[model samples]
Target: MTTDAGQYDDQGEVPLAGYAALASVLATGVGAYALVARSRGVRLPERLPPWDVVLLGVATYKTSRLLTRDKVTSFVRAPFTRRTGHGEANEVLDEPRGTGVRRAVGDLLCCPFCTSAWAATALMCSYTASPRLTRMVCGGLGAVTVADWLQYAWTWTQRTAGQ
Candidate 1:
């Protein structure tokens, strides 16, 4: 049952339909990948190497942060979200706007943890289609991730030394 606004209930407004649509899109994407891989005679790897897995994990983390939090990428999320404030490390804080699908998308776009699933899926698909290119891309992202950590460490060290 919905509230008078037709968007809320006892548990408040939950975008069930919107979430389902997003899930459907994800499923469709995976299914398409499988079909394309099979049709192109691509062989699935028996198992991913531990190093490759680590690379993908770092890449996914960085990619997710880039898409969801970076100030430069806010334009992509602006349509579905409203800027509320600035966040740490050159990130923007945004609140999901609108209702239903739009809000669902905004929620996904604003959350690094949520977006990481999509990033990992895309990276895995790329790896399946072209391991060499995927590895290069993952390597670059992984490098950036390390560099970011180092930058933070440097700042922290300076602050500590000053104190």
Candidate 2:
């Protein structure tokens, strides 16, 4: 959504809001997708490049997390593993120092790390008020999130970095 000036807020004057919105929506999508993919054990088409996964995860995660809100943040924080003993809610997005988000986003080399990083970034980016972004976030808050993440998982296996 652009401002009264007909300028896309995020395109320049206020990019953070847009970015945050993107992040929030993607977070919901990724979280829901991760949960569903884990349950269905969906398979990817092929192996993606080593860095491709990371790049994709980073790009997607950062894009998703451009927003921030308790509900949205909480939704984005959905845990990959069902093992509750692993950590707390607030801790889900918190990864090793420079390992998950930055590292995952940078090397663009690992799938698991990149996936987790993307989730974290989404949760981190959520912090604003954009109906478009919020609506997008809500849209993915349900099964749609699951579907999107599953798509991402499939995307992961389609990389070609190994060859």
Candidate 3:
């Protein structure tokens, strides 16, 4: 286990300081956006179509990184072969409540945002890696972008319809 923190462990290497900085910048941007939205009276809601997912995803992903870094990552017994941890070994694992809706929104935001960022870098290797991999990533991104568009369209339609 190697840590950018200058150590090695069985858990492998911790992410570089670059990931930490990137996460921090993302967190700040999301927080600032939320604050600005609130100031404008654009009340951010917590639900299926919540724009808040951007912030939550950033924070949650960051938290996951921190938790994993601490080497306190927990594991549970698997079913089929009595194996533990994630993957097909634990097919019956339950997603925490709110995770679905939250991740739905995350999928609707995070992927697209990330896709753009990685594509912009050109070195992220996610965009032009392989046709199949690129398609999967872009497809996932399109899902979120489409959902976001549809959400805005629906809201606009409702407002115009006096809803």
State residue 2's C-alpha deviation in candidate 3, in Å.
47
lDDT of 2 by residue, 49-96 (tens): 554444434445434432221224433333311112222222223322
Error of model 2, residue 120, in angstroms = 18
Better of 2 and 3 by TM-score: 3
Which candidate achieves the best lDDT against the true structure? Answer: 1
lDDT of 1 by residue, 7-98 (tens): 45676567778888998999999999999899999888888999999999999999999998899999999999999999877888888888
- Whole-model lDDT for model 1 versus the true structure? 0.91
lDDT of 2: 0.41
- Ranked by lDDT, top first: 1, 2, 3
**What TM-score, over all chains together, does every model reach?**
0.92, 0.22, 0.28
lDDT of 1 at 139: 97
Number of clashes recorded per candidate = 0, 32, 3
- The runs of at least 3 residues in candidate 3 whose Cα sits more than 4 Å from the true structure, single-residue gaps closed, are 1-119, 122-124
Candidate that would win on TM-score: 1
Query: For model 3, which pairs clash?
Result: 1-8, 1-9, 2-13
- Tens-place lDDT per residue, model 3, 1-163, is 3455545445543333434555576568666756765676654223322332343344344333322222223231111112123432112222211233333323223233443442333312222233346445445555654565687798789889995
| Candidate 1 residue runs with Cα over 4 Å from true position | 1-11
